[model samples]
Target: MNRSVYLASTLLICGATFAQAAPITAISELSMSHSFIINGGSEPAGIEIDTEPNSLTQSADATSQVDRPGFTPTDTSDVQVGNSFSDPPTPFEAQRTNSQTNLGNGDVATASYDVSILVENDPDIGNAEEDPIRRAVERSGIAAVSNAADPINAEAASSFTNTRDYRFTNTTDDAISFNIVGQFEAEMRAEHNGPEGFARTSGSFEMLFETGPGVDITYFPVAPYLITVDEDDPGASVAEMFFADDGAIAGVTFSGGASAIADGTQVEASLTAQTRYVFSITLEGGASMLLETAFTQVNAVQVAVPTATPVPLPASLPLLLAGLGGVAVLRRRRG
Candidate 1:
């Protein structure tokens, strides 16, 4: 064959081999969901009282009365909800054998005071304490309290009592909120040196919350758990998923914007083995959203790797080579 024809044939063969060698594979595709719970509580309520000496009689044939102070244990548990109590248990009557104890030798009168405060519709379980979300709530609550108090009298001795109630509800269609309460017990000791010499005083206290539903009672800093992901159909694309505490999705990350996963978008997620992911997806501008959970599927594609494809050579190379060969054959025949 002529030089042109030989070059053309070589080009055609290279194009076919390059096309077969091209790689077309799918890369990584992953889906994930965030699990959340809602928690809240009402304000505490109580009362305070102040008393002063009323009278004093001197060394004459006269009588006088003195003022005394007393306080009753406020029934904080009455307004508290979701706390469990033992049945057929010993009543306070058994606990308190007598009322009124007197100390010191002096003619004294007593003043008794009682007050009550109400707290309603608060969250008591998940997200109720030092968690990130609860921290924000606590900070806000503290700010409100600070603003309400008199700055000059902030440290004055004042009696405070308040009854609070809390509730936790699972609103997610596919997932349920697990409500838990944690109790912390600790002791603090301090040593001081006075005219009497070194002395140490240690105090211990316990805090309890009346969970309206039940008491979970766990330690602080609970470990994280696995959130599930939903499965996408073959060749189908999933856009975004919404997450909420106790299922309130509004104004949350899933509401919209950067945090949302849009159509044709890619997501990379690393999940612990043997863990589950529960997710809910609400389409853009759609009225309803779908909730799904990930499970162990043998054929499920956990990871993906993308492949690259090569460029194809010109298609006219083979035709050009055949035409050049025909010209060479004609010239040979004429000769």
Candidate 2:
């Protein structure tokens, strides 16, 4: 599983770093890409979902993007895709409610969501068509969103909504709490890129989350479970936590740059931009619901250092630029 591979590699790398450097105990892969069951009650009233970033903003070069998860509750015993509620369950990132669509047909059984912003003009232009995530999904014969839409106007959202069973989405900025039957272990993470380009670290560079300009990342008073720096896949099954000593999380952060080189051209030519950052989780607690502002950016791209000639940026240049500032992998696990 990619989840296990992600945690295992993080453990091996960060463990060594922390051991050698004052026992920092900080892991490089602070990103997340898994979901937990919301089985909290005989029936859950609703799940409180928030995709807003809870990390701090330390510098201008950093960026952290949030990927939303789909809500999936069975209308029947069989766990078939048709039985699930939300459209395209994996990689969900919108904020709609049961009115959109849902499962079980109960008063609040279904829900739906639509993208608010697909692309940006101020910083990254014509990014939708070049979306790496979307491209990856398309390769699997499924459809998912990158951010906004075609002819993407400055700040307009999409018009379509995903309605399905156990409704949930990759929505941002707001927590939509609809009547639900299960208690979800909802966790937020700096979403990552896969093997496609510079890797998942592109979106996670902004992982150093902060609730306020100078405030620390802490747990919400009413959180159901203790928020800690832990692994997912093998984590849920393993006895001990994957990353740290199962340290409780106060906040999340990142520190990265070209170890060999920083120039965009050099990184691509050498294929070294993939491994460019290290993520760490701060040990703090006693809070929940975090917020911050972020700019829409792409990951570090695989620049083909021109052997003899310089050329214009491709239509995919926007996506390419987005890839410029992310994870140091293999050394290579982004969120």
Candidate 3:
């Protein structure tokens, strides 16, 4: 009694915002990723469970003189799973923080910065039957500025969110099915130097493939697919956007901008499916006010699960030589 046993769950969200001015330099970055792999000879054998619970936060702040007197400002924050211990496994190396501020020469001086992360999950079981498991996550944001003389202001912001749930059943009895190949990416960068310097970046993504239960699940489309961009924007007050969504094969949206000098944008997508899947991404960015200097960076999300190749057969085999010439002409008319 096997009815193709396979279940999965995941939910991710993101947010961002940054502004700059005064000998300004601005940078904004973002990231969100997901990966999956199933083995047992494609499916049907048995055990295949996964688990990943996470929640992370990162922060950085800088402020310049509020009127007089030094007033050096810089703030930092790091949180793991709402506190109380017992939840931390996603840092895998890549927790960053930066803040800088100076107020002395000019008149209006200021500097601001931000970075954020959020991950949520529950329901995990391990045992991929025998190898074949990969999971990933990335959250980023960066802001930079140079050329200050009072009349200074700067800001940076970043965000992240992660969630996971996967289960594949079939303790024998046969009957199982699962296959998924994936890819998602987005990146942006900007630089400015006068004419009110400015920079911008944005993001939105979603993926869903389901069946049965809770509000009746049903989604299609997950077949031969490919969308490209890989990098664009040479300058000239640049601007860019990426899109995807035609019912089911769902999710994809990105934005870019430039003013006074630099620009950057990157995008990519490739997918294939045979069942359970869920995805999400959200991002934002901005830069403003700059007498001469600005920089901004943004990364929407990058997810990959490469490993699914087996689609060849068309070298003019002509239906296997016409079924071997009809079994040798029926064995030469039975000799």
Worst 10 residues of 3 by lDDT: 1-10
Better of 1 and 3 by lDDT: 3
Error of 2 at 6 (Å): 16
- lDDT tens digits, residues 1-335, model 3? 01000000000000011223333332222232333333312432353332312311222333222333453555554543221122642323223333333344322222222222222222132222111233333333433333333222333333332223233333444333344333344343334332222333333223232222211222223432333222233322333333333342233222333222222122211111122232321111111110010012232111111124523223222112122222222222211
| Candidate 1, position 186, lDDT | 15
Put down candidate 2 lDDT per residue, 1-335, tens digits, no spaces.
23323432443343333332221111111122211112221112232223333322222121121222231332211111111122332232232221111122110111111122221111121123221111111000000111111111011011121111111232333332321111111111111111121211112221223232222222222222333332232111101111211133322222221111112221111111111112221212222333221222212212121234434333233222223222211122223
Best by TM-score: 3
Note each model's CA RMSD in angstroms.
39.0, 21.3, 21.2
The CA lDDT of each predicted structure is: 0.18, 0.20, 0.28
Query: Lowest-lDDT window of 10 residues in candidate 1?
Result: 138-147
RMSD of 1: 39.0
TM-score of each: 0.16, 0.21, 0.32
Candidate 2 Cα outliers beyond 4 Å, as residue runs: 1-90, 93-250, 255-289, 292-335
Tally clashing residue pairs in candidate 1: 25
Give the alpha carbon lDDT tens digit for every residue of 161-267 in model 1: 11112222223333322222222111111111111111111111111122222212222334332223222321222122222222222111221100111121232
- Residue 14 of model 2 has an lDDT of 38
For model 2, the run of ten residues with the poorest summed lDDT:
136-145
